[model samples]
Target chain A: MSIVRLLIGGATPRALALLAALLAFLVAAPAFLGPYALSVAILILYFAFVGQAWNIMMGFAGQLSLGHALYAGLGGYIAAGLFFHYGIGPWVGAFVAVAVAVLAGCIVGYLGFRFSLAGVYFALLTIAFSEFTRIAFDHWTWAGGSGGLFLKVQGGVTDILNLRGGATLFYYAILILAVGAFVLCRLLLESRLGRYWLAIREDAEAAQAVGVPVFRCKMIAIAISAALTALAGVWNAFYYNNLFPETAFAMGRSIEITLAPIIGGLGTLFGPIVGAVVLTGMGELFTDLTEHLKISGLKQIFYGLALLVIVIWRPAGVWPWLAKRLGVEERGR
Target chain B: MSGARLEIEALGKRFRGLRAVHDVSFAVPAGAIHALIGPNGAGKTTIFNMIAGVFPPDAGAVRLDGRPISGLRPDLVCAAGVGRTFQIVKPFKGLSVLENVTVGALHRHADLETARERAGAILDALELGDRRHQLAEALTLPDRKRLEVARALATEPTLLLLDEVMAGLRPTEVDRMVTFLRDLNARTGITVLLIEHVMRAVMALAAHVVVVSSGEKIAEGTPAEIARHQAVLDVYLGDAAGDAA
Candidate 1:
């Protein structure tokens, strides 16, 4: 029963219809929107996908990470490097990126779990690793180093197969990634592994007493999260056609990826999606406001204010409040 | 039904130059109710921790079914059919009662569907069926304690370790718990080892008893025999007698 429910997204009939309608609108969005609006939609979906990737680790497994850029940066470099140097397509490079990301995740997870580093300390460890990688990449000469790596963009009609397509192709790609991430997260939440993660998250000692292999479960969460995030990184690289260690691996990038889920809701399926929409929409609004007023830093201020309001008034996050208002009781809580 | 299943051989633990437990040895026979009673800070819980593999013992061994399990991790020990509850209840506060038990059941049943079915049955058996959908944080203290036991039981343990499960309960609730545990033991054929401070519940439930004081065992016998043991009386019950007088 749960299998069928999770497969269909565990929504009521009305919610199912609402979701289908929303997805259909998003799928056909490019036809109606201008280039600028389409770009914003793509940005929203990109953040949503990456945010869901981070959610698996911190939201489900209760492992807070502040340096998710490690995976994203590594993924971008691997895919771009293969395409730029070895003439490999991102189609195959994506797999390599995922593999490398999972491997890095294992190493970090092993070190952190072995040393019993957790919570803020674990978050710090992730940041330290990402920063270290960024510094190393900055000095290295291969793949353009500090100069940045750029992919060959053949100017023509949209090339959907090669990912050299226009904004429309990128938009659809991000939409697919976001929806895929949501379904994957929902399925994971109903799985046995998900139960073990919640148990460990709630109380590690009690979880161990109940026969949960805490370390293994945590490692699995980290590996899966890193792999998924790497996919998003590959997408980002292909869409932008360039990668700079400073921008790609920045601490701000990690914080930006996590902000959506934190505002939407931490442990819910649609939290990242909802959070991404709100954050991206407000960001666009603030950018427009700043442009008209000739003011800078309004975007940052808006983000800070949104985060403060969510943390204070809606600690469980906007998704749960929205659910309550909509009279929808979420399952698998 | 009669042979010893868990044997603690001179188990000892020390923390920062303080001996929390030392030279503690006892055996819980299969299908028997064994109680470990001690005064506050008497190392009863320390002994429980050692037996449950929460941490490695400084010295000596813990054996389950004549096999050493002292240094095994808590999850491995539980996998070997030894389940335990914390003195302070640790339910998954964000989870429903069924979800909490399902986590425990997942230890034995890898499939979530099977685990959920078994967890449901366990909750029903524990009289928590009506509250299956409620968040664990919403449960009252007594119900939470029952949920704790229900969780451990869902693991299908051969030997169940309960820590201070009767604390802070009303008289009627305590009685209900005693009856519940007795019925559980009779139905499940699980060996029971409990660390408890409530003497009335201990006396009514435990057939065998070990008394401890200040990190050492003071007496070991049947509950009634230890109730009258001179060392136990002087260290524990004698104080109660003096307070009453």
Candidate 2:
């Protein structure tokens, strides 16, 4: 264990150097790339951030949430609506969104925990809530209902006042959010709560027998997960300058968020990031291939196949494989 | 004698139509090693379960230090200074031996460092220091029993309810356990309520003995007194009473 720690401590400098170089590369990429490519990069970072947020609940705490996108959608809509109607900045609106998400998360967590609902049942509850919220939002015309709300396009490129600007702004903004989410998850996974969560995940009955407040720990996980996911929602709203219930709160969107962590490695710190990169890269590659071949629904088919293959071949996910190569200790039961 | 007392009054637990335990009553006085001896299906474990709050009795009450604790959650019962080990030891199979005890320590000490320190001390005292890093599932049956006791002890319970801890141990192992229990009770003054089938060990260690037959307390007295009781001889000794000459 000391040797593992020493290796990790020694690698910190090199890791930081690599991260710095990657940041530099990303910062410079938009300067030379076309508008389309930059948009894709921004989307990749956005998914990675949301994936990390979802990872906190599902990966770390082992709480499967099929409706996590509800928090993200609600967060984005609340922030975007508040800003559009009351002249609130996205910065202030983001906190409100997070607060709302936490409250909603608590409600969901309480209902689930109170009834001792877990495994597939908990996942089903999340989906049910998200679907209910989506339908309600679809009928609410203030945010344009099913037609969706589109932000007024600013005439100039440097329209920072309205948070509507060029591709560079979105890219940098999402990069920061993704990095922040990664750091937040890292800190949480190393803290006392992390071990408690792991214990609960491994054996909740035994954990409670030993004095871990199982419900409270699970609630905390949900709140943190919701708060981080809401921040991603705020980013989604600002970057796109649009809100639509079907697209934002869809089950497909939740699955997309869950897939990153599932594919990369469910519980590891870097699993979500790796998963996000692979899913996003594959998505982009598939889109290009489909466009050239004029194949309909090819991307979804490919993604489904990929998921099935990964589950069959490497059920533990990509992180274990990467950990072996990188000499990091594998963490999950 | 640390003033630990466990009292069960008219405790009745019925499963569907069958009464597993009926009107069973017993008191384990402070600082005494009390043994509950019964034949198989005599409701010894069911009585322990009720005291440990595994299930609330259909009728009657359980008290710890004169405070009613019946129907309370298991963790709350533990917090009220009543710690229990299961008849079938349920250690956290995935966790290491040290981590298993750490969970108990965490109940009283929230801080991981303090919990770890307390757990380490317990492992040392239990002679489990060498196997602290091994997963609990890999431990031998005797070690698992020790770990169960250690885990319960880490909770710092004033009253320790040990259920058939020596069930599968060999004679020598049982002797070593008897010595450990004697030392623990003598030094720590943690009141012990042990349910056991080993008549020899129970007779040697228990200061007070309660004999149960078919969920009813047929006898309660000192070890020697119970040993001489004809009812105990009839219920427990059975045909072996002739060999006891």
Candidate 3:
């Protein structure tokens, strides 16, 4: 039985079949693609994973965090640092990375929700925290300061446990992660907790009148989201073989994390993946085109135009509209 | 099984310098349909807010079945067996009608399937079963009002607070709501504390009536007694006369 059909929500059987086929195609993708193309596929899966992490916070719970790169960056530094300085494996270090990321999310969620900072104010608070981390990490010499941190790839042995393997190994690992994120999000969406999240997202005061615990539910959203985002950070460190404080905690990177879900469909189960595919595919295509044409900055302008067009064309996003056209749309979504 | 299902004594609130509610007290008996009636801005809703824990009073105490509930957060107040409806009737716009009520029902069942079943039952009882899958924001005003009441009832509350659930309702719709509420109270033995200005529904549904005027409790008795009370009459007819003059 396909995992799509096993999901608790009542997706149309046609939709399930379509999803299963897409997964099969992705699983077989490396056979048909070159090294460079395989790398782009890896980028899509990464964005899909991280985008869902951000979606659970802003999309499902409606608590916007504009500085989500902090979680990823912090997780990467912790895991990579442990692996580099101490000879611990990335698998073991991932635990510590996830815990730290959860702690950071909790602190930010607590201060924001407790003090009634909402919407743009909460977003600004997140940006401030990320900015603070960036500046602090730039001066911290122990972790290589702004110059960056490098993972010492072991000389001869290809240790899969340590996450030192070929590109295909990393590709399969990320595929499992993206699929896992989708399943987990579906499970959470089908639970009683998900109902409370929707209520809080729509009208928090109304939710409280009928017994939904707004504060605690929001906190849980952030914690789970941070934990998943941290795992993505761990993957990034090992795959890239290096991390720079400037690139890891960059404000531009933080904004990019939100682009996928917003363009695909916020709060929908498949929005993040769909958003990831379109945005990353278009972004890479534009970058390649601009490079070939000897033009420098057309990539960003194209991205901005795509975002503008999508927002103006379908504010609710491409997935909802596409689902409707495909005859697989859920009611009341 | 007890004295008052809900009680507030000397309940007072102030908005900066202005006293919104002061020296007001009342007790609602178990299984009774009670009404708090007043003209617009008479602080009836203010008293409701204090009881439902939207805000604490400047000075007073609120009790449910003889246990203090004042100063609890709104969600905690609900967990303490109180459920409330807002005058504005803002349902979760992204959620279906069933999902909106299921959020409240989960308070009792603590799971998705049972909560959804309970919400379905409440929707059927409230004649919203047909529109169960519709987005809450898509409902008509009367339907939205009914959705507010339905959602509150799904919580399995011992005491329900209703703030103008019948406001903006047509006469026939109001009558239907009154009948449904009266039947609900009689069948379930759930206590109801309603803030309303719809006198006809008040007379039909409420066994006990409390009237407030300018943030002060002016009268309290059976509906018949309150209709005949001079102070209640002055607050209503006197205000009308002043309006005319």
- Measured against the true two-chain complex, the DockQ scores of the candidates, in the order shown, are 0.85, 0.37, 0.80
The runs of at least 3 residues in candidate 2 whose Cα sits more than 4 Å from the true structure, single-residue gaps closed, are A1-41, A155-162, A292-294, A330-333, B1-3, B137-142, B169-172, B198-204, B223-245
Q: Candidate 1 lDDT, tens digit per residue, A1-333?
A: 566666775578877777789899999999999999999999999999999999999899999999899999999889988988888888899999999999988888998887889899999999998899899889877867899999988776676656777899899988998998888888888888988888888988899999999999999999999999999999999999999999988999999989889999998888898899988998888889888888788777876887787789988879888977876657757
What is the lDDT, from 0 to 100, of the residue B21 in candidate 2? 86
Root-mean-square deviation of candidate 1: 2.1
Residue pairs in candidate 1 whose N, alpha carbon or C atoms collide under 3 angstroms: none
Put down candidate 1 lDDT per residue, B153-184, tens digits, no spaces: 88998999999999988888888889988987
Output per-candidate TM-scores for chain A, rounded to 2 decimals.
0.96, 0.91, 0.95
Each prediction's TM-score versus the true structure = 0.96, 0.86, 0.96
Q: In candidate 3, which residue pairs clash?
A: none
The Cα error of candidate 1 at residue B242, in Å, is 9.9
Q: Candidate 1, what DockQ? A: 0.85
- Pairs that collide in candidate 2 are none
- Candidate number with the higher DockQ (1 or 2): 1
How much is the lDDT of residue A45 in candidate 3? 94
**Candidate 1 Cα errors over 4 Å, as ranges:** A1-5, B1-4, B237-245
**Residue-by-residue lDDT tens digits, candidate 3, A54-161:** 999998999999989899999999999998899888899999999999999999999999998999999999999988999999998877899999987665557788
